[model samples]
Target: MAEVRDGYKITELGEIPLEWDVVQQGDISVFYNGRAYKQTEFKNSGTPIIRIQNLTGIKEPVYSDLILEEQKYANPGDLLYAWSATFGPYIWNGPRSIFHYHIWRIEINEKILDKLFYYYRLDFVSRELQGKKNGFSFVHITKSLMESHKIALPPLKEQQKIAEILSSVDTQIEQTEQLIEKTKELKKGLMQQLLTKGIGHTEFKQSELGEIPVTWGVASFEELGVFFKGKGIAKKDLSELGEPCILYGQLYTTYKEVIKEIVYRTDIKVKNPVIGYANDLLIPSSGETAIDIATSAALMVDCVLIGGDINLFRPNQSIDSRFVSFQLNSTRKEDLAKLAQGSSVYHLYAPSLSGFKILIAPLEEQQKIASILSTVDAEIASYEQEKAKYEELKKGLMQQLLTGKIRVKVDA
Candidate 1:
């Protein structure tokens, strides 16, 4: 029922170039199921057992003293697919390990298909098949289902070219991620020093918050701010076009240490609706956990509607709002977390927040610290955007190159 484009033909895997062949994934490769291990077989040290968690890097590797058939083991560089609760294709970069039963060791026939190309093909297929199978216990894709999956294959050389292009994009994404991590580490080190020690200070004095700069002052949070509770707006009341708003939940899910721009809006009407002021520190009054209850962000804009379950702190003229937000999120997080109380769902009240103590720097010093941290945050955001752009580029290339919608140059 679909029209075939010129120079393309209709096939079981859909329309592909005239020179390409429609092949069952199993036809060009062999799938070897790994051995399932018994509890007693696990040991303190020997051969590592690769579980689904090991492949995903969620848990540490468990070792086994028992030896099994050679087919049960996967060595470095072997392409593998985890088809259990977590589904994806992985090229093993770890030591030689016996893979669990849930994983399939794919051995490609390289004469007709390049191994790297098949790896990319399997990755594409796995992503498509993920979460679509309805009746399974937990995305339990069987080996037969994977083997029987249909795919369009181009010439071996063309496959290699497609794989090379995708791999280059992947490398860029990896490097960008590394830069993001390094910048975060730098922020952590700077916060630890700046909050406690004043810049270029030689004298130090003991305070309730440990040793601080001699000239710095200490005060309870209530001394510097007025607490107000946001009223009325609920999740269902939010809409696409209306007055800009900040919800309590967004404090944890959306905004960070500082709120730059509002993403949510609502048209709902309420009596005595609360509006946030610039430099107001926002904290979620209720959350699923104590750590979540402690999360806070400073509103940088004026006149936005503030929803329920959020506590707003309006600082005095002398204090910097970003400085207070960074201090609470970094240096004072554990202390603030302890104030949160509840058995199931935690709640942090304005009264508890008011009594919390903080070290105060001169207005000029506070602004300087905030400026340095904000610049680092901007750098991280730029790298994140670059990473996302490359990922999108790879996704588009896969859709085009894999199906021969766009062909790569090959030697005669």
Candidate 2:
């Protein structure tokens, strides 16, 4: 390989300082495959089995009555690599859980390698490892293939320094995440209360939905706004620059609460472009789960073309669309789900949307409620931006520190 600098040489991974060594990852850390625990083995209480579902804290991982060999037990802060449908390196923070077959237990040879450093290194290249998985419907990472992967090894002190730097960023991210969760809880309460009880109201009245403020009126979604189903845009019709478009899938991924910017634009011919109007709320009409895709975002301008599986709700001037969207998030999701069709992917059709009832206030009152909630949304966005900036900084540091472009001091 050609020398990149006087003290640096290009290697298989990348350019590195001459002092550092490139070695097989297996040489530094030994990997053990987890036992494939089955449904029949599940018990009400025992050691919690870490499943792919539990990775996102979606569901509490179940327990197993059957005890496995010594190597299978995983503890808090142990490094684990999950490879199947979802792939990544995770510092196991849960209890002493029996891991599923999809996850691997990684043991560092402390004499040569630091656990945190290798975890961060594995995290840095997790996407690359994920790409190595073989399967069409599902991906699997074999122990043999992962053991042969290469790593750029640094001195123990430098490795610890890099890990410390990355760990500090992770600490900031964790704190920010907690703050985000708290802020969300606060916002949710505001949505539920403000949308129903309203601002500073002493009087209350009962209705089919629930008891709401006396001054507030109840209305079907049809009365407050008009609903439209979007057309399906074929893959052949997509391009970089064309008429600005909003896709159904994007409703779940992008565009939260209030959207001032649109991400996608389409070039291909559209039969009937269901252009977005001012104050039009867009949300997924169908998704894997009703609760997940139930969220909505309101547009502030006229945009052309809306993709299928998305339902558009254009509120009349009498109501604030963003306010109503927040209210839906707080209340109407379960109601909407009740009307959803299909089993696998629940769909919210026109009839269901029209029949849905909501507690409403006057236009000015609606605007005031929306403004108060928007302030909370802005605060959450600020925290998210800060967390993202810290993550970006860590990513830049990893690239430099791992490659040895920037040197870290090692104490004797």
Candidate 2 global lDDT: 0.81
- Candidate 1: residue pairs that collide: none
lDDT of each: 0.89, 0.81
Task: Report the lDDT tens digits of candidate 2 across residue range 101-212.
Answer: 8889999988878889988888766655545445223466667767787878888888999899889999999999999999999998988788878899998899887888
Candidate 2 residue pairs in backbone clash: none
User: Candidate 2 regions off by >4 Å?
Assistant: 10-14, 131-138, 232-236, 268-272, 283-285, 292-295, 308-310
Could you say which candidate leads in TM-score? Answer: 1
| Cα lDDT for residue 230, candidate 1 | 96
Worst 10 contiguous positions by lDDT, candidate 1: 130-139
Model 2 Cα shift for residue 111 (angstroms): 1.9
Q: Give the TM-score comparing model 2 with the true structure, all chains together.
A: 0.89
Root-mean-square deviation of every model? 2.1, 2.8
